[model samples]
Target: MADLSLEQADIIGRVALERARAGNSQPLTVVVLDAGGHVKLARREDGSGIARFDIAHGKAWGALGMGISSRGLAARAAKMGTFFTALAAVTEGRMVPVPGGVLIRDGGNRIIGAVGISGDTSDVDEACAVAGIEAAGLAADIEER
Candidate 1:
């Protein structure tokens, strides 16, 4: 069983909001998912663009589905463009090979779910996402899965 819970999701969202505020940028959208890729929680900060939420969700979903961080996916996509592109189509465009998503892991490095943030550059978004996961006391790899 996974250790992920709604409380952790809330913590992640709060941390993301804090990071976004610290950066003095637009509001961010945060999403958290369970091991099975089900949404555990999602928050759309006020003034965030509507599209931001979808991007955040896609990142989180992709992380959970791949059992790895979205950053890893992006790297692989760069090496295998055609295959990754086809995967996006097969996933109905839900699988996004972009940064801003990090897979949550337990103390033993067991995958739990993922957290994703949007409303900034891909790098900034990914940093915020990783920050939130760290704030929630979850283990996550910033560069690799």
Candidate 2:
């Protein structure tokens, strides 16, 4: 699979931030991860909470690590909280079952990375991630479960 470049990651971050601003949401934290589940870039808007970055990272990592959107994971968690909690422990608290993490796919439909957003409602956060991924000329896999 192809890797998401720094330039693309930067674009995603910028676009996500802009989307959050346009919606008048809370100061957001955006995190982008490469195909290997490594962080390529991360941004926390001014006035964002201190733990926002951690939540963003966890969402992205969870999506990439599980090969599914964080929203899907969240859905599963809702149905199986105990198992999902175990999953969280297994991931050393890296995986977050939330609605903001989405997969980024390249032109050939290969997963390139993931993006996670925080500081807004789950649906709004997810919209920001999708917008950023699309703005970067990539596909956003925001699975709804």
Candidate 3:
């Protein structure tokens, strides 16, 4: 699968930050992952915590690995918290079921990977993530958002 370009990732970060600004969210952290759930790009704006990167990456990775939005995973987890906890353990603590991450689909609606954003409320984070995906001319599905 063709990987998301760094240029595209940069644009995604920029768009997300701009959207967050419009929404009154503080500094943000944005991460993009490839189809294999590998980091393609990560950006943390000034004042964003270093831990934000881990949160963003975890959300993106979880979405890609489960082939669903993090919000959907969170919903499923809400019904089985222990299972979701075990999943995090199985992933070596890299997976997180949250509302801030979304799968990225190409023009054909094929899953290409995901984008994650953190440093705000889950709803705001999701908004930034969705904005990034849409700005990249891709589709984002957050069934449980």
In lDDT terms, which candidate is top? Answer: 2
What value of lDDT does candidate 2 attain over all alpha carbons?
0.92
Scored by TM-score, the top model is 2
Question: In model 3, where is the ten-residue run with the lowest total lDDT?
Answer: 1-10
- TM-scores for all candidates? 0.92, 0.96, 0.94
Q: Which lDDT values do the candidates have, in the order given?
A: 0.84, 0.92, 0.87
Reference-based lDDT, residue 5, model 2: 94
- What's the CA error at residue 17 for candidate 2, in Å? 0.6
* Best of the two (1, 2) by lDDT: 2
lDDT of 3 by residue, 3-80 (tens): 677777777888988999988888999999988888888888899998999999989999988898999998999899
* Two-way lDDT contest, 1 vs 3, winner: 3
Question: What is the Cα-based TM-score of model 2?
Answer: 0.96
How close to the true structure is residue 57 of candidate 1, measured as C-alpha lDDT? 86
Runs in model 2 deviating more than 4 A are: none
- Cα lDDT over the full model 1: 0.84
